[model samples]
Target: MNDEIGRRLREAAEAHQPDRDRMLARVHRGMAGTAVPRRSSGIARSWPKVVLAGSAAAGILAVAGLAVAGSVQTTPAHPDSETTLTVPSPSETPATHSPGTTGGTPPPAPGHPNRTTTARPPAGTPTPAAPAGRRVSEGPLSAQGAIDPHSTVYWAQATLTLDVAEPLTAFTVEVRVTQNGGVQSTGQWQTGPAGDFTVTAQESDGAVVYRWELKPGRTVPAARHTFAVQYNHTAGARNADADGYRVQATASDGIHTVQGGFTPAG
Candidate 1:
């Protein structure tokens, strides 16, 4: 009976014994697991906030850089503070015209034949109406002065026609051109024989004078004759209103004198 009681007490004490090593192992494992998650969760939450802040700063920098680049593109290379720059577009650009081409025809190209070019005169200086075939008569001489039809803007020719009803023993013809802006004589000619006349050109009293006179003992038979004078002028249609011509002759009937002024030709 003593042995049985001792064996039962031993079995009960073994069953109630505490497992200290197993409990200590479980507690250490639980603490390690909880500590790792706390550190990992803290890093995860802060990483997103840092990324978001960095993205916002990058966007602001990009916008500022674009604004600076735009400013550089619009500014002038050399700026003048007192002047304003106006850049004309292709559609609004102005056309260019040649100098000395106002109110007159442009000069012909090289090697081109001469032609009659007409245009309207400038404002405030109207072109005069041309007269008909009118003649000024003095005794037996009938004379007329006219501007040539082929006159150009830079040059002009004036013609004087004389009709003699009788034989002439002495004759003289003269043409006077006023100095209306750079007028200068170029040449003169007549329909009569060149050796039978004495021709001269001179400047006097603000005019260019061209004269043709019959040589000594030279006789002019009753006929019609034409005389012409050419000169250069300003680059525009010249006004012949101040130009004139005169003729004197000793005919069979009497000494006759005639004078006239130039009229624009058709």
Candidate 2:
């Protein structure tokens, strides 16, 4: 054969000999553990010492921008609980100027109250004289001052116990009272301008005579009618304000009947 196949390929290229020193001693021990080559002392490799260290960090940021524009109005470092300005003194200014301070309209404080009425007046009218002498207590029906529970304007308060004689003649007196009897108070002549007779009906027996009866087609004024039977502050006045009211009488007139009244008012 061809020289024994060229002598076994030259003994396999003389038994592979190519370790290149052992791969150059393992790349010089891996470039001898890196990091360690400073000493350029900056400027030497220079870009003008990095442009003079960036112009000294921009002149320390332009002197810290002129120390924050010279403290623009300093103030508030801490200290203020009351600079004082309270206010609230005018009512013509008189808190006594100052001393415990006070002048008026501040009284109710002793008992605590600024404005209170809640509401009242509907059920009041029945005390027929007992304050000491005006005697006239026939059977619980007495509170006769007539409107003015606090200034009821037109006025109203009627009570006639009977005893007339001081002045009674304005269409011959004719009073009435029968609302629950199902309406029956024929209107007539009483309210001012001198039309007289807002209410003056009599004759439960003593006969001051004429309680109410002017119905000749009724032109309207009243037996005592402002509104027939009116005495309503009914808590505050509304509708049927008033007319002939304030009649307190105690009868001795012409004769006989325990007498007990209160009209004009106290």
Candidate 3:
């Protein structure tokens, strides 16, 4: 039986001829079918279309990512139009307007002034009255007369100023105050030495005549001299308009004589 089986196996092996090329082709097809699936005919023929579709999908995804990034970069969180506030400095502020000030400039402080003012005496205070008439000049002597402002309502003084241009060998000054209402000589004086002059005051010819004569041998140098005659008057402002003075002097040049009247005063 073993011999018969061996002969039958040998006969069967010899009868089936070994086709090596067909067997190799069969093995390659089996390996392709099991390890890697065989593509369909339509898939193999449209491979370019499949690859194109995949590339188009990747481009769309890249474009979408770029668009998202561009939106994030371009879009602003806040609006373009913004509000700005401006504050004024203290110096730029406008000044308040005031009366008597021009162009908005403030006026000088109170009790302060840009210009000076002439001070004047208060009301009821006495002011010296200026001479009413022109000065009297004769030869080397000139005389001006005015009423003393220091006089009151009941008393007054007549003043005489003498400008002597040369030394006087003889000099005599007389002030006559007319008795406007009630006038009487109270006293008399001179700017020269009292001992060098002889003063005599008396009422004569409806007036109080005050005379000052240089004493004998007494010299009066070239200078200015003042002579005043004080008197009592009525209980009101005295009318010195009628009052007059006379100055006579004998100098080296010649005899000088000047006469003038005082201004009215109280």
lDDT values of the candidates? 0.69, 0.31, 0.65
Name the runs in model 1 displaced over 4 angstroms: 1-135
Model 2's TM-score against the true structure: 0.20
Give me the runs in candidate 2 sitting further than 4 Å from their true place: 1-79, 82-149, 152-163, 166-232, 235-266
- Model 3 segments more than 4 A misplaced: 1-135
> What does candidate 2's lDDT look like per residue over 35-134, in tens digits?
4444233323453454556556655555544444443444445766778887766876653322223232211111112212111112442222222223
Among the numbered candidates, top lDDT falls to 1
Which candidate, 2 or 3, would have the higher lDDT against the true structure?
3
Total backbone clashes of model 1? Answer: 0
TM-scores, in order shown? 0.52, 0.20, 0.48
Model 3 residue 213 distance off true place after TM-score fit, in angstroms: 1.1
- Per-residue CA lDDT of model 3 for 1-266, tens digit only, reads 44444455445543543444664565556555653445544445555575566566656655655454444433335757878898997789974433223332222212212212212223553222222444499788888788877766666767788888878999877777887776765666667777787666656677766767788999998899887777666655556777787777898877877777886653
Which pairs of residues collide in candidate 3? none
Candidate 1, residues 1-266, lDDT tens digits: the string is 44444455445543453444664565555556765877657655665565566566655655555444444433335755686799998789864434344555433322212211222223453222222223489767898789989877777889898888887999988788888877877777777777778777666677777777798899877789888888777777678888888787998778887877998978
